[model samples]
Target: MNQTRRKRRPDPSLSRLDSLSPEMLFPAKSPSLTSSRIRYIFLLLTFCFIIYIIFSYGTTFRREQISSIARSLSVFSTRRRHLLFSIAASHDSWLRRSSYVRLWYSPESTRAVVFLDRGGLESDLTLPPVIVSKDVSRFPYNFPGGLRSAIRVARVVKETVDLGDKDVRWFVFGDDDTVFFVDNLVTVLSKYDHRKWYYVGSNSEFYDQNVRYSFDMAFGGGGFAISASLAKVLAKVLDSCLMRYSHMYGSDSRIFSCVAELGVTLTHEPGFHQIDVRGNIFGLLCAHPLSPLVSLHHLDAVDPFFPKRNRTESVAHLIGAASFDSARILQQSVCYDSLNTVTVSVVWGYAVQVYEGNKLLPDLLTLQKTFSTWRRGSGVQSNYMFSTREYPRDPCGRPLVFFLDSVGSDGTEGTWSNYNLHRVGNCHRAEAVERLERVRVLSRKLKHDVEQMVAPRRQCCDISSPYNKSMVINIRQCMPDELIAMNT
Candidate 1:
């Protein structure tokens, strides 16, 4: 009867629930704990985000560093594509000298621009593209007897840089008559880092010329190379440099003065020959320095490189052998025949000299003065940069000389070069030496790595007894501790 009085027995579950806190009872919508829970979640999310950002950035930086290292160590090889040739020439000389350019310049592989004083009908597709140099009349030239063209020629460095060629590493400059052994040039240039400033070339062979100009100057006729990085900086400041060096004698002197201002000195690469001497260069070519033959200049001023051939023919002849093994071209390899008391000097791809008696290596290295001084003078003016021994006046007294006749690749890494005896006269030669009419040189194609190029050692040669009027000589890498002497 009394629903109101029906104090229902207190349910244990209801009592327990009634005694619990609201936060515990209604857990999902509890406001008191919401703020702290949100704060904890926010802190956790922030920490994760920070870690993610740091990891992402660190990963990118590490990847970039590794990529840079790989590029430097693996992909930074210097090749022909890295070189840009800037040939200085006049309209008058280009016609005659273009032959020399043709010998080395390859349109498909070699990048070059010939800066002529004026544009001519240079329609030959085989030659390098010709561009007329900008007017240099604004610059002053005060050298007493020097041509004003020196200013124009010196500006070729700037002009070449303005060309905006992409991926260039070096800018090589030379006279029109300069004949480049392009393959060897690439090898020599690969020895240096293109990212740094380098002025690589050699001085004139004539002592007086070096004194008059500078021992540090790179004779333009011989050719020189400027690293692209330095060339760009030099281009911006060359005009001011030219104005200051107006009294300089030649274009090379102007370039040298400008480079000196930039704190760059000549890195003498003995391979670039400023053949300042006139007449026969047989002696010079026979005793080439223990380096790759890079270039030859003043061909027109000197006699034909080979006797009985015209100048162009002789150069083509040399290039013919160069096409086979450019690194070995004109490389001197001395080997002695101890049993016969004979010494043989093989100018690979060029000539061979067979001597009757054993000649000292140092003596063979000295250039014979077969050519006259650059200038007709006595004493200091006649001096040369290299050591010289008097070339016998009589041809009969000289060693039996043989010139390159033909060369062929053996299809394996080796080549065979046949050198025919260059008969001077009926000289009294040792029967053994007289019997040989040809020299057959067997050698592998020279492939120099960076280490070999940096620390080059002369190659060793082995000589065989003469047979059938022919002598066989094999050229190979020198063994450890091997000596290039009579006894060795």
Candidate 2:
């Protein structure tokens, strides 16, 4: 086996492989392909960083923007200087109706212009400046028994906007005879956003009138408001819109149609009173809605506000009371004295009703039918917009009445209003309430914020035991969980 062993030579292929360089085993790629791959990786990393940033800080940025907007809005609360009034009137009625305007108009503070059919009148410092309406002869009218002057009245909206008043927030429209509680008007308008479109007012009290015209229409006599933003747009398109609504009967109807064309509807406020009724309005004034009294219309059609005073004097009396505390005017408050079995309802700055037994608050809030219907008819025609209870024809069945005698401040944030007993029918009254000859109500001036105006709650009142032929009542905010009911 040893003699057979022999050495063999290496193969030619193996010797060639061992001699090759290191570059042959690992090769390099082109520069273009390598550069493209690097760029793709960089782009993906940058996109992920951007998405993380947005998720971390986007909500904070949005919150800061909203805060800035709210601060700007708070700086400009509505004031008397923010309103511009355009009163529609005629030369024939101006002399008589101007008196009504003077009652509420303040030469120094109120900004108003009376739009008359004709100009050329003696200048009076007591009245607002007068402007003759632009001729509206071109507009068409097809309604039977309707006046063409409605076109002129409707045009007042355009003419007022053209005046170019600076810093005006609201443009208010009213009839010459309409009486507005300006302070209360300002309070109500402050609750709305003037930057948006708004149409604020009320309809007629009579159901028939609403059916005859439109339940959605805001009666012009009651007065109405247009936000400055909406007024500008409405003024531009009113003429063309008037051409389309030529068949409408009243000026308010024309304005309503034009506003409707813009996709806006009436924003009803119960404070505006059309007073579409006849005879005494005692019941209406006594049971006013739980809101500030904004405006009153049709003073000539109804009896004087007070029993003995003339029409103008009666209105002046109410206005005098309003001058002290307009926000509380006509606000009704009910309370009961359980020990004496007596119930009393106080209409601040207006009147007072004293009942014998424990009367429910809901029953006292209903309107008493002391006045007749707006139209002479039966059934639906005589119906009213609100709930009403029949006023007793026999004086003996009625409660004791008291009318506002005077009102004044209490030298602080508080104020006092005095009411004198209005002697009526010689009816036998309950022992607890018969001797009451006067009522003195003590309250603080109402200053409501936006939240309170949005969701108003009825105030609570406490009555002091009757003393020396007089009674005292203190009105205050209700306590949490308090109920207005007779004590068990």
Candidate 3:
């Protein structure tokens, strides 16, 4: 029995050592130590993830906070009633005037005053607007047929001011082609008291002919606003003033000259855009502005402001979208294109296609990658592209970085890829490359121009006001030559 037991036990060294598992044999580790190592790795990963999240969403958070505060304070709420006058030509095709007329014909249209040419079926037709004929007998001043409309401006001012609604604080005037963002206009006017005489408007000098007019003159096409007090003063004296400037080349310059006689200088407001360009102004509209966009003129020739195939639908859509918070829209909306060619950046939640005249040579993907890496390294957080779901896809068929995708019920958010038909197509690679290069160059230049426009600005007219040295500065009035000389 003893011999059999010894055989079963075997040699202690060989049996115990050889039969034991590797873990047991090699100095059994503390279970606590293994758990501690795992904990350490988990903590490191968690910290990294937190940092990434903060970096991505910090700006968006701050922007939203600012917007919330502004809304809470009711900075945009104004008790004053505003009256808008849309000047229209009688002979112009209905199609040409239809868009602008229909634009103001909303609940807001109740406040608008529309003037049409006399002796036509178009003039006789009743619309939503407060219809008024461009009656020659309304005022005594009439020079040439060309200046006939110009002569009527004072009459319109007189008619509006005479209505004597104490609530009416502002009288705005614009061409038939002008499109007003009513909310923004109200915000701008709220900064000034209606009791004081204020002539607010923007200037234009893209053309050499613009130099012929007073540098201080506000372009009428861009639209101009007058305080109630000033409108009253003008109502009494405008006919006399018109007689003096009857020979002036343009109505806007003549009006400016007349206002100068009344000791009221043009209060340059950059929000009003006089878009005199013949082609699409997508870039100009999409770029950041020094102030809230109040109006856009000359919509007759440019591409529709919104992203609809039908021009009429685009205008209607734009008017509808204008009801939201302008500041929040500007900050939150981000748009980009895949052709890497033209990128339509959203300024105030509005984007217009921007094409470049010159082509640059750079790999768009490479630039994007570089920018991403730099942003990460710098710890700059971005939540411009958001996904509520665990997994998000780019439907626009564009590179993931281009535009933001809409958050949906399916637990995912992505761009509407079907909308970008041109991007995913089998277009010529060479052409695509060329266009992309142009876009790169234009984007860089546009960025620089925007920076310059928004930099610490001092107005030529407001020398008493301290020069601001902030990133978000108002558009300061400078000599017309300054803007005219720019290659942009």
Candidate 4:
């Protein structure tokens, strides 16, 4: 019995050892360690995901913050301006490198900065602008130290795409050296609505008193609200005229050329001063205000010294002091919305179509230009050049004789004309075209012989060959002694 019991006990112990699973025992009871490893991997994934979320949130928050800040501050400026945005580099360093960012960050123009970011390469970015002013104007050259004003304007355009996107309708270009104060400008804007038309340029001295239909326009100082198309035309004029009129590329004449090329309805604002400062500021909105004194050519900076940087501030203070203080100005108003950029474009063509019964030396050109300009409380195309005249008389009333469009009987039909129907007899389109061309050449000769008779007394008296610019095709201003047609 003892032997049997001892054998059974050993058998039981052997069986217990054999009953354990090979995988369970081989791994060595490391359940806790396995659990710890899985938990660690899960924790690492969670941590990484959380970090990603936070970083993403931070980036989004920063953009929102910038947009929010811009929207908050631009509610009350006198001029509604656009600020375009763009990242010019792959990293933030290039943005920091530009002088624009420095000037943008400057306290003086701090309000002007909608964004300063690192946009990579040649791409453009336009941000929504804060309509800080009630009246809308554009401030493109916000920074100093750049030969490319167009680039600066491009940047500004990028910055101000979204603000007042639907209502933001105009652009006024002023320099940093001008008397520009955000608060006062805003005050002025709020009081008057400039979105009524496509363009409104500054005033120039208007001295011609004797010419028929001759506008006694004030000297247009330029740099005012123009249609997007007019602005484009001005740029094109600059490009083309720069090549043609190489000697006359100064800002002043170039500006005049731009105005002429657009054939925009030109009028002026006596308030838009060219220079505002001191005694200049005293009478005008600022010192040397354009109206106070058209332009201060007399300031010979004490033996030809360069103008100080403070000139901008000087102009700003002087202009700000008086222009912003008008009693008729409106109070600032607030709105709860973001300023986002809106895309804008302007397209324009030659002001007249001779085929439409318009005449060479066509006043119809001027009439078309004048009428095309979007008027206050009127519906019109933006590309129509605007005039700044207070009177409702022909806004774009300028003589348009597109002699260049003619090749003189090239298309034949003898330049068909109702005037010569009896003399030349019925002709085909080609013969009529040719006839019209012959008539054009003869009329031009006749006009050359009687230049003094056709043109106004002033222009005719001073120049020996003033008719060089004139190309009379049909009847003068195409009038059967009609007052409306004859006046121009």
User: What's each prediction's TM-score?
Assistant: 0.86, 0.85, 0.54, 0.27
Q: What is the clash count for each candidate, in the order shown?
A: 0, 0, 10, 95
Candidate 1 positional error at 325, Å: 1.2
- Estimate every model's Cα lDDT from 0 to 1: 0.89, 0.89, 0.50, 0.29
Query: Could you give candidate 1's per-residue lDDT for residues 270-387 as a string of tens digits?
Result: 9999999999998999889878999999999899988789998999999889998888899899999998889999998889998888899999999998898888745545688888
| lDDT over C-alpha atoms for residue 267 of model 2 | 96
**Candidate 2, run of 10 with poorest lDDT:** 22-31
Q: Output the number of the TM-score-best candidate.
A: 1
lDDT of 2 by residue, 418-459 (tens): 999989878888778778899999999987777778889889
Residues 1-488, candidate 3: write the lDDT tens digits: 45544345556688577677544544335653365666676699899999998778779897998898875554334542455454544445444675675664555334665665544444323443444554655444444555566666545666666667655677888777777777667767777666678999977624333555666778888899988778888878867766676676566776677788889998888788776554444434434344766887777666664443455665555555444333222221222223333322223334312222222211211111111111233544322111111111332333211111111122232111101112434434323232331111001001112344346231221111221211111112356554211122
- Candidate 1 regions with alpha-carbon error over 4 angstroms: 1-57, 74-76, 378-380, 466-468
Clash-forming residue pairs, model 3: 55-381, 56-381, 56-382, 330-348, 359-438, 360-437, 395-417, 396-417, 405-414, 405-415
Relative to the true structure, candidate 2 reaches a TM of: 0.85
RMSD of 2: 14.9
Q: Note the residue pairs that clash in candidate 1.
A: none
Off by over 4 Å in 3: 1-80, 84-96, 108-110, 119-127, 134-147, 205-209, 306-308, 328-345, 352-488
Candidate 3's TM-score reads 0.54
Candidate 4 per-residue lDDT over residues 1-488, each given as its tens digit: 45554353456656686676544434535554465665676699899999888777667787999898875554433343431112121134333333222222224332332322223334323322222221112322222453333333333332343332433424444332222233323332333333232334344321221121123222222234444434444544444443443333123333444466556455443344432111211111111111211122111111111122243333332232223222111111111101111110000000111121223322211212121221233542323112222222431322111211222222422221111111222334322122333112211111111233224121110111112223132212223333322112
Q: Is candidate 2 or candidate 4 better by TM-score?
A: 2
Comparison by lDDT, 2 against 4, better one: 2
Candidate 2 lDDT (Cα, 0 to 1): 0.89
